[model samples]
Target: MDGALEKSISFILFIIIGIILKKKISSGDETNGLKSLILTLALPATIFIALLKVKVDGNLVLYPILALGFNVILFAFTPFLIKFIGIDENSAKDRSARLLIPSLAPGLSCFPFILEFLGDDALAKTAMADLGNKFFVLFLLYLVALKWHYKNADFEANSLKSKLKSLFKTLIYEPVNMFIIVALILVSFGITIDKLPNFLSITLNRLSFIMTPLVLIFIGLAVKIKKQQFYQIFSLLILRASFTLFLIVGIILFVDITIKKDILIMIAFTLSSASFWPFAHISAVHFKEKRENTKEKTFDPNFALSILALSLPISVLLILGILTAGNTFTEINSILFLGTLLFLIGIIFPIINKIKKFLSKTTKEIKPITKKKKIQLIADK
Candidate 1:
């Protein structure tokens, strides 16, 4: 087998192992423990090494801007799709969908795969892209969620300065962000991974080594989706991913992405799973609603949970499948075909439900009358 196919098999096997081990893993806490290790240690080290390995130039500035722009587009597009899907406007579920669909969580979902498949340089580019996403998720979306809270309840938001200050602190203090900043600073000077002390380099590389396996296992163990909202969530995620592909296709047509690896990076990075931060924002609002003793909520916790639970696995499948395909999806026609296929896939269930409803209604309208019933009616007359 080719190298790509072989690597893809290994990744799938690791995930399967995790799923098998899920039977032995008793609690959410264990999954959380593994996640903590990845986010705090392995992921950061991986990003640090990736960034150090690459040459960070001026064009790198556009990455975050592009990422943030994609978020805004998805945010704007979500409501129309939600309404078209027959959800009630401004309802808890609608609000939750709006917040979660647009946000990208590359740390857990995309980074490891990028490193393994696209190499360190591509991973570095994706890491830079996450900075803008972090800002959007941490600050802008937080404000939106807070506004939602204040709209429904009697609460006050702090001054912009205070909120910005706190958010700035939160951004800097995060392990991933810290590693990114440090790596960028080192790169700004004349330092590369090779220039680093041998001991530190060895340790970081070792930590990075465990990231891919740990992440895949966590995905297998952690994905807890209920059947209640499966179709809705699955359909929404499909539409979300389809829209993402179309958007990328538009860009590829206009922009100059020559390298297959670069094109894969664009596809994989933009298609990262929905961020957990939005759900955190949703939970914060839920907490305040509880404290205020309010009957109504700003966002549906269960809906948000459903989105988060299913997003990673779906995105993992997508990113893995796309990246593994190598040059198959590098052209415009292939991408358009894939996106169209996903769009159709997303709409098929809803269409089937509508058809079922229509058939039922028509059957009810045309009730068949038997000869005995007709004779009985004539006799009564």
Candidate 2:
């Protein structure tokens, strides 16, 4: 618990420091560059390092299938649920997007943490599971959902084909995938690299350390909560949380897959939050559309930010509660605790923003009276 608490605190501190430094040193371009680094470099490296040494087994192989199956079930049944709930088509598409997009990086988000907690063997199995989920999301659900959302627009097919091509390109170029392939080839031939020079291993290990916190901070930096969209954002958060919880329970009960408790916690964490990348993509697309129309668009930065911020803490707490409640808090407790800490750190940004907004408003109101008094004094002079 202490270690987890410390990790949470450290996560919060680093994010705050990053945000502050970003404000001072990072222009919009720099911030964008930071995002690019996370997506292209840090995240992929982390995934590769974590999965490279992992050992896969039959149970591990089934986990991703179960994850993909659950996602498929959600995508198929959620539309019907939306229809029954009387949500409009546009709203249903948004709901589906929220549900489907996060499945893309379940492994990326959870695998490193799982590796830290469970070890290479568990991570390898989890990677296999993650690989399945990523393939299903990127290739299947992502394309289908994009088509559903944009089907009626002019140039729909062209747009869909473009998106499919983008997805394929992403898959082909992803460092994580390349790493997996290389690692698999190595492992298949019984070529052991674990005995590699200590210095290189240390270097890779240090690089891997940068991956998780950088990602969490990137998530924090990306999500900016505004005042007006609080209610709507909160509702969406509840929707995501509810859906993830339901999926977790269903997989545990109905699925024949057997994973260790730590892995289960990782799966729960991975599925529980929406993917930050898709939100960035959606936001970018919306921004472009608004620009082309020559109309100002109200993009809800806070909505996704709030969702991510809230999801982290909830996931950490959920993981901790489950572990502690089951009395299964073994060696992995440190990792679970760290995860919870990271989430708690995530929650603070919104709170800080709210406070800053309140103070800014108060200062603005006070400034008018001070200006009036100064003007009156000048007249008297």
Candidate 3:
């Protein structure tokens, strides 16, 4: 718990610094540069290091599959959740949430905590889990965005094959993917990061060290909030948390994840923040379509931004609480903890609305005496 708290505090401090820099210095270009540093250098180096450290085997294979299974299941269920929350099916939020809510962004939010609290083995497992999610974000979500962009339009008119080819090209050329490919080859031959040349290993270690602060600061710089969309974002957050809680309970009841450390990892993974890459891909499509003067609404940038802004704090608090509890709580207590949270979020808003209405009615019912009536009463007296 202390470790979790310390890590959380440090993470927030970096984010706050980023926010201040964005406000005072107009670090827009700098922030973009930092993000490029992350995607092109820091993140890829970090991934390669993690991949090389872990033994590639049957248990390792289970991680990506488990992660992908979670993504797919959540994806299948999101539409119903969207409908339940009363979001308009035709709205841009709907389109974006379908992609955003199901994906996991452990790199930015979860990794630092794992490193600080659970050490490298846990971090390795988390990184492995993230591979499946990365695949979804880079490939499947890209196709979904393209489809939404050209849905009503003719495929031949837009040269769909060329568009897809371009998309695939973008995916393959990303430094992250390239590094993954290289790392896989190395691991296949029983190589590890330590076996690399001294200079290369030192340089990579330094780059990877910057990953946490740089990513957290970039996230802070990128935080843009829309007041109108806040409620929708909150609803989506609640929905995500509730579903995750349900899954946690299911795991406790049915699964044999007996190791406390593993259980903690699973809980944290289940509650990881939604990834930003899907939003990035979707935003690119929207921007390109806007340039081309396409009339169809593509994706909602505001909605995506809202999710990004809210997900960090939501995920941090959940992880912090779980970690502070220290994996000692019984299964019933774990269920009760999540159940209480779910209950509060579900019931609080309606109760507040009812209270507001009652107060309004009571205020309207009481009237002030008019001057004429007061004068008549005084004269009569």
For lDDT, the strongest prediction is 1
Query: Candidate 3 vs. truth: CA RMSD?
Result: 6.3
* Count: clashes, candidate 2: 3
Q: How does model 1 fare in lDDT? A: 0.80
Candidate 3 lDDT over residue span 208-266, tens digit each: 99987886777678767665456657766776777877776676678755677877787
Give candidate 2 regions above 4 Å deviation.
Answer: 25-27, 76-131, 136-205, 243-271, 276-305, 327-381
The sequence of per-residue lDDT tens digits that candidate 2 reaches over residues 169-228 is: 745665555665665676678654485578866776777677767766765666565554
Collision pairs in model 2: 4-337, 4-338, 8-341
Error (Å) of candidate 3 at residue 21 is: 2.0
Candidate 2 has its poorest 10 consecutive residues by lDDT at 294-303
**Where is model 3 poorest over a 10-residue stretch in terms of lDDT?**
327-336
- For candidate 1, write residues 1-381 as lDDT tens digits: 645345555765777788789889964678657766876798779878977886546878899899999899889999987876667898999999999999998876788778877888897789878877877886689788877766765435556676567556656776777898998899899799999999999999999999878866765666556664688788889988999999999888788777888888889988888886686577656865787688888898667867876787788888878877878888889899999999999997678777987999887766655556888899999
Q: Rate the local accuracy (lDDT) of all candidates.
A: 0.80, 0.53, 0.75
Q: What TM-score does candidate 2 reach?
A: 0.60
